[model samples]
Target: MTNEQVIRSFFETVRSGKDPDQAPHYMANEVLAHQINGENRVTVHRTPQNYADHVREMIDAFGTFQLTVEEVISQDPKVYVRWQQRGTHIGEYEGYAPTGKEIIELASAVYRLEECKIVEYWIQIDRLGILEQLKRNQM
Candidate 1:
């Protein structure tokens, strides 16, 4: 599969709220993920198994979710994706208890692929907006 296709399938698997059965096919043995939220930033290097576990944790936190791909642009080893994610806050996130509020968040990611496997990625999402929604629901 192409890099774009791999990304689409990866998101689709996460959106389905099921354990990813094909994750190993799309992700490299070692992947570097850079995530930033508000003033906090984190970077994790994960094996395919570790990444799968991380994805599962996210799915569990978000509950049922949908990812709408707004754009996918690819040039050789680099691919960029812009997407919007909609879901209900049904599980704990970042030390905040679930508020059962619906959220719509936009995010973009850049991925570097080698031999159709994703090796590195940088992802940024609307973290502040999501937190605001959760805080509003708490009141």
Candidate 2:
């Protein structure tokens, strides 16, 4: 599969709440995951199983969210993707109690692939926007 195809499949299978167990097929044994929110950046090392668990956590909070790939651009070893995710807040997330509110999140990531497996990624998501939605009724 091409780099773009790998990223698309990763989103479809692992992130779209379809089947997160397929993470091993797309990610390397040790992957570097960078989370960027404005000026704050943090890096975490992940195995395929760990990545799968992360997706499971997301499912726990969002409850079978729908992810739509908005754009994809690829060069050689790098692929960039923009996606929009929509779901209901059915479980606790980031200290926020579930409010049964519909949440829409926009995220983008640039993934670096080795062979056909994802080796590293830098991602940004609209987490603050989701927090704002969660804070609406509390305030």
Per-model TM-score, in order, reads: 0.87, 0.95
**Predicted candidate 2, C-alpha RMSD:** 1.1
For residues 1-139, could you state the per-residue lDDT of candidate 1 as single tens digits? 8777877787677434455656787788888988965688889897778777776776677776777889989887888989887778788887778888787888898999998888998889988887888788778
Worst 10 residues of 2 by lDDT: 130-139
Q: Which regions of candidate 1 fall more than 4 Å away from where they truly are?
A: 14-19, 36-41
- How high is the lDDT of residue 59 in model 1? 68
For residues 86-127, write the lDDT of model 2, one tens digit per residue. Answer: 888889998988888788999999999999999999999998
The regions of model 2 sitting more than 4 angstroms off are 137-139
Name the lDDT of candidate 2.
0.90
Q: Give the TM-score of candidate 1.
A: 0.87
Q: What C-alpha lDDT values do all the predictions have? A: 0.79, 0.90
The positional error of residue 113 in candidate 2, measured at the CA in angstroms, is 0.2
Cα distance off (Å), candidate 1, residue 83: 1.0
TM-score of 2: 0.95
